[model samples]
Target: MTGADEALARDALRCGELTILGRIRSASNTTFLCEAAWSDRIVHCVYKPVAGEQPLWDFPDGTLAGREVGSYLVSAALGWNIVPHTIIREGPAGPGMLQLWVDQPGDTDDTEPDGPDLVDICPPGSVPPGYLSVLRAYDYAGNDVTLVHADDPRLRRMAVFDVIVNNADRKGGHILAGVDGRVYGVDHGVSLHVQDKLRTVLWGWAGKPIDDETLESIADLGEQLAGPLAEQLREHITPAEVAALRRRVRTLLAEPVMPGPDRHRPIPWPAF
Candidate 1:
């Protein structure tokens, strides 16, 4: 259950030889489960190539990997470390976002509703205590379901992080329950959008007052957003996107509450 050494993981991601084990068949982009080896250390990492990124009308082209890195920077700035150590570096497939892989418990899905129907129609009965149902819809299989997220403190922290980043996709599958009993968030390529496109599964704190400690964290994030963090982000993302992130941080600090979902669409597809 020990976490991977960040320095070792980052070094491997940067210079180690990557052996692609196989492609993880995600809906949006081509993701590879890879092993990076250098010297005596080996690390497992997720690799998302810029060439494999699907075009989105809203976000700029070939910028997903940078957004992924940007999310990592923001996660680090907030002192949450919810995201794994991620970096943008050249790979066999040109440039990509390489991140350390998180190993989750085998029974992490114990609370997940079984079958397509049960999964799609996430009934309140299926939801564990201390979680809230924020979304309800029918899956591609046409089975009705509800989307629920934990009201746990860790998830609440991520909710605030997502709000600050304007995370566009936060599916249930994207939330990782690490073997070390830590929660991790992955697949941030669709996050940090310039628009108010905060589509996510974490709506448990909507309209709720953010706790004082969490607000302090947000305040620290806001200050960093205006200073060195924005400068660092500029090296990866466009000036416009950096400015947009700054705006989001400012607004969140001003309100200090869990904002509701978008008026049009609130949840990501294939909510698994």
Candidate 2:
């Protein structure tokens, strides 16, 4: 999206008429499929109100919205459009996280049910070429089904971003692909915790050496987190969390390698 497009989108989110379309239920907050309108333009957005968030044991309550924005800021500082255009603003239900819904190019044409990790993904004897089956399950009628995913490089990039943010719930369903071959990641409210709770499904590039370009990006972000990015992030998350982000940047730069899974838990629940 262009700068003008992003500005307009944010304006629509901040000042347009917000109409709640419906509800989107997940593991945490009460999500909504909403639309905001302004002068002949209508933008669909994901709305998560503060009042609807479920309290967590590790992370603070009512701060998920801020974390969502923080994730975007980190991605922006890295110079990668991994997350969508997100903003924190007031809505009808009170202040919350409002993210512009991204359109997946040719997304409606994706008849294939394939990705990195999941259970009971497709029907038996229907695995596509170059795809591998990882798990199996039974359909509701007791019919057999198999889970499969293809090796997409987009996921590898996402994995790197997730590690940088300490994303705790990188479920398969959060990954979205575009017709331009660019993948956009969503649902970042459970991320940036000041802990080692990095659970995700994009472990394909584990232990891989960091490329020069990616390393440069990491170094650039580290500098920003210590400077301007730190100022922007302090508006949303705790000062300690921002410090944790800087620490994560330094750790990744020093190690310069993809990390293995945590000993306790490496993947999110309901993986999709």
Candidate 3:
């Protein structure tokens, strides 16, 4: 993270309707899952506001600033159906960004045939299944993707939009497959990489030809990017940053079946 990123994070945190849920110990940066008040609805939110400087992890280029910019751009440009809202909150220390949280789907039944955490891909957990089930509850795949995809092409567009955004952590759990079958992506704290930092399992479409609807969406985005959407992003990111994002959009529109991580490439360790 750079100085600009810190400043942006501080600004976002200081101004939203956010209530901290708790600190997430697994992330490298200071992260908190919170609740965001958006209009009449209160949505689950995630905040990653750092109090002090942290080492930069650049395999995924772009600062935290870039990720924030990417989030705003995706929503405005693609209407990817990513949760349509935001909450900027203030901490005793400084500001933080708040994202609309999608409620976790599935029975969440704590009992009955629970499985290993999505991250625990191994020869079955050696310990009692309880430990594995507990851990896997929040793991990827715990949420149901099929239900969300049931009604909307928007869900798939969001997945593709994430690929274009270079989101490195679109884990299964990050996607909320609502009872209404609407899908929302969360934990976009890592996105807008200048490099190929995209490490997601949605590559089920990798190597496949891009569909027409997907291509038109990309085109639609290009038209919108030059308008009000671009102006909105101008407030938080520099003109250069915004331009780079536009360039990325152009690239995606040009080559629908863009290259992603190599088919069998290993997942990047510690996604956030």
Candidate 4:
């Protein structure tokens, strides 16, 4: 989507104009399920304006411009369809980023067969069953290394995207399986770090060898970084940030295999 598309998706009213779809109460922040108009399409989004601390981290002090840029990079880099559709105006809390709403999987009305029991890590009185879940889970700060790949290329792409961003809260709950067997990833506010803060359960592939296809894609991404991809991200992020992302891409491409969590792994506790 062009910057114009991003601009059109914005709603000046922020929280007021958007429809309050629901609320997600997790160990970290209290997110409002929101929807706003973007041309003919209605975008689904989660507005987490620094509610509290639990997942060990929250957005920066004010509007997280980095998230908008990171989401754009992930969506553009890999063919994985991440949500961040638009960046809405913010009040004192934070800028509301509009994301594409993905329909939850396993709905009776849909056709895809069910997979294993994906746990809903919502608080006791919070989550209702049948709602879609993000691929990452809450409170996964201290959990053992668990990867999100299920042999699906799309899912694998999502994992690579998270790795590049140095995501810290990729809990099992954040991975939402759509009714069409497509998984959707969300909750990427705290990313693009210079530290090795990789803390997720997607460790099944850890210590395992990286496949040639993914390796090739990583190489291609590296090349793209110095080309058009870099240009695209320049609109939302600084050139230095783009350069840093390119460095990460190069590291992933040059490395023989992806790294797994070791003694230095950050405690998986939420920072609410």
Total colliding residue pairs, candidate 3: 13
The better-scoring model by TM-score among 2 and 3 is: 2
* Tens digits of per-residue lDDT for model 4, 1-272: 35564455444223334666777765245567776654465655656553333343433333344454566565656655553443445523455454555567444465655543343344433433433322344445654322233544555566677777777767666677765466666776666555566676455455556678877767777777778877776665556656777788788877856666684653244322
Worst 10 residues of 4 by lDDT: 126-135
RMSDs, each prediction?
Answer: 3.4, 3.6, 9.4, 7.8
How much lDDT does each candidate structure score? Answer: 0.80, 0.79, 0.55, 0.57
Q: Model 1 segments beyond 4 Å from truth?
A: 1-4, 107-121, 124-127, 139-144
lDDT of 3 by residue, 1-272 (tens): 24564345444443435677787776567777776543444445566663532546553343453355457657656655574344444653366555544444354654432453322333223433322211221236455221111213544566577766767776655656554556666666666655556766454444556688778877887787788877876665456656766777787777777454564542443322
Point out where model 3 deviates above 4 Å. Answer: 1-18, 35-44, 57-66, 106-155, 258-260, 263-266, 270-272
**What tens digits encode model 2's per-residue C-alpha lDDT throughout 180-245?**
456788999988888788987666566788777888999999888778789998898888888888
The TM-score, computed over Cα atoms with residue i paired to residue i, of candidate 4 is 0.66
* Candidate 4 local Cα displacement, residue 150, angstroms: 3.9
TM, every model: 0.89, 0.84, 0.65, 0.66
The C-alpha stretches of model 4 lying farther than 4 A from their native spots are 1-17, 38-43, 49-65, 82-94, 106-115, 118-152, 231-241, 270-272
Stretches of model 2 off by over 4 angstroms after superposition: 1-4, 105-150
Cα deviation of 60, candidate 4, in Å? 5.1
Weakest 10 consecutive residues of candidate 3 by summed lDDT? 130-139
Kindly give the stretch of ten consecutive residues in candidate 2 with the minimal lDDT sum. Answer: 111-120
